[model samples]
Target: MSRRKKRRKQEEEHMDESWLVPYADILTLLLALFIVLFAASSIDAQKFQQIASSFNNVLDGGSSIMEYQAPKQPELESLPIVEEEKKPLEEKSDKQKDKEELEELQRKINKYIKQNKLDDALQTKLTEEGLLVTLQDGALFDSASAKVRAEDAELAREISELLVLNPPRKIIISGHTDNVPINNHEFESNWHLSVMRSVNFMKILLENEKLNPSYFSARGLGEYEPIATNETVEGRAKNRRVEILILPHADLQP
Candidate 1:
């Protein structure tokens, strides 16, 4: 009978928590009611954050996160610049126009040379340096004379007129000579002959009022600079010639 009573007491002590379960359910209901009330209050997140930032700024005496700031720009050195490449097409067009003008001038001179049947004595070439007009010595001079022939002076004038640009260009009239040294016709050496020949030819060219004398320069290359071999007759003849070179770029239009 005592064992039965002890067992009953133990079972009552370990009863399946029915009263505690109702208490737990009441606590949970209170929690849910508090959550519903809090949710109905409707707090604005952005305003709350801004107010928090303001309080932080006041407390710490630092800049506020809510303050306006201009966006940052890239550094000047980091930028990809093209100051030189601006107007690239314009620069190329200017150079091309200058080349075309030179070609046109060469064509005119070549036409003149062909019409006058002076092909053997005169030739025109347009090089990178500019327009080059080469004239044989025999076409403008006698055996040992430096003076240009009277008949050829007209030709020189015609060429001088053709050479006139809108704005004049620098023209170098260079005289070349064969290896044979001269001591006749008032020329003491090949140097004197070459110099005088270039000077006389340039003087005739400058007689045209359209041509500028200051733009013309006379140079003498006395057997020192030869285009052909000095050992052969044909080579010597080829070496004895005059050259007129119109220099580049000084008269370009902007």
Candidate 2:
């Protein structure tokens, strides 16, 4: 009877030791699961991907529940740019051609005056007002006379021919006289003399059918618009004159 009781106590001790092996195994599995959850929460995208790959390789034979995907970026819309166009080259070329033509006309008039030995009685200048042709009063009229000389009528005809060479532009004929007072049967004052002189000269220029009648006009400034002093005879002679102004086409007054 004593041997049987000792045998039963040894069997109970062996049963208690057998239960300890299964409990150790359950604790080890729970610890591994908690460590995996903690790493997934704190790790960056790259490290998480590496850990997922390691877990797959070690535990599930390369298959995994966790997946690593990169975030997508947003796209932007494009817009078109606009620019202004410049002036045409042909317009600039046309302006240059007009300037050259005006310069050539000036040269031709100067050459003609030089050849005829008319430099003393006639003067020419190219200015902002266009070509200016100045003729002394003595060359076209006698003392205190508004009548043009017979020989000087030829000068007016020649000038008209030259004007026909250019395009139609404003032609202004203005007459001026010295400050000396004058009262005669034919004229009352210097103003009357100046007006008659300018009108007569313009009439001769109009005899050419090629010249435009509408483009021509006349003015008489009298003694108030003298170019020189009335204190001397030479100065007074210079002040008494007729001026022909050829204005640019763009500068014509309405």
Candidate 3:
């Protein structure tokens, strides 16, 4: 009977171990919740990669977890944005009208040049930017002289009349020379020749007081701004000429 009682007591002791199992299960559940919370809190992809790499190193028993900041990408500043204002329609139409008028005037000048048989002595060209009137050296003046001939007076008068009848535009008179130097007693060099030529022609053009003197200027480019090469006589002859440039007025109808 005593042995049976002891066996029963041992069985009861074994049943008491079931309470320890519940406590162990509770601890396991708490540990699992803690792990989930830690995982949720540290969710950065770069941090995760570093932690995984660290864990791999630890598993191999190599090194401790290394904490390093991620390399930051450079931030580029935004470029300035500029919005252009559109021109008005009236301004555009006015520009077109000015261009048309300039073309018509160029045609009229060419007709005049042909009618007066001045094409041989002079050349007229309407360029992309302005009109160019070139007068040959012999046609305008004698060799090494800045004096305008009596025969050229008629041509000058015609040009002045045409300009006065038309819209006002600025005029630029320029003189050029060949590569050969001048040794005149009165003039020092080719620079003087070019400058005197421009000045004399300008003086004749401004003979009329009614003409706007402020609209004209004279410049001497010497042999530097030649239109042709100095290698051939013909080229040098072509370079020794005078140019009358008519520029569109900035504040005029254009």
Question: Each candidate: what lDDT?
Answer: 0.79, 0.79, 0.75
Worst 10 residues of 1 by lDDT: 65-74
Candidates 2 and 3 compared by lDDT, better number? 2
Mark the regions of model 3 whose C-alpha exceeds 4 Å error after superposition.
1-92, 252-254
Q: Which parts of model 1 have CA positions greater than 4 angstroms off? A: 1-81, 87-92, 251-254
- Per-residue accuracy of model 3 over 177-210 as CA lDDT, tens digit each: 8989888787888888999998888788778665
**lDDT per residue (tens digit) for residues 1-254 in model 2:** 69889999999999989767555445545544655677665567866666556555535434332333322333566754333223345545665666566678878888989999899988888777778889999989988888889999999899888888556878899999998888999989999999999999999999999998899999888998887889999999999999998876672322
Clashing pairs in 3: none
lDDT of 1 by residue, 141-233 (tens): 987788888987888888888888986788999998998978874988998889989999999988888887888899898899998999999
Where in model 2 is the C-alpha error above 4 Å? 1-97, 251-254
TM-score of 1: 0.65
Winner of 1 and 3 under TM-score: 1
Q: Residue 107 of candidate 1: its Cα lDDT?
A: 90
Candidate number with the higher lDDT (1 or 3) = 1
Candidate 2 global TM-score: 0.62
The clash count for each model shown is 0, 0, 0
RMSD (Cα, Å) for all candidates, in order, is 13.0, 14.7, 13.1
Candidate 1 clashes between residue pairs 3 or more apart in a chain or in different chains: none
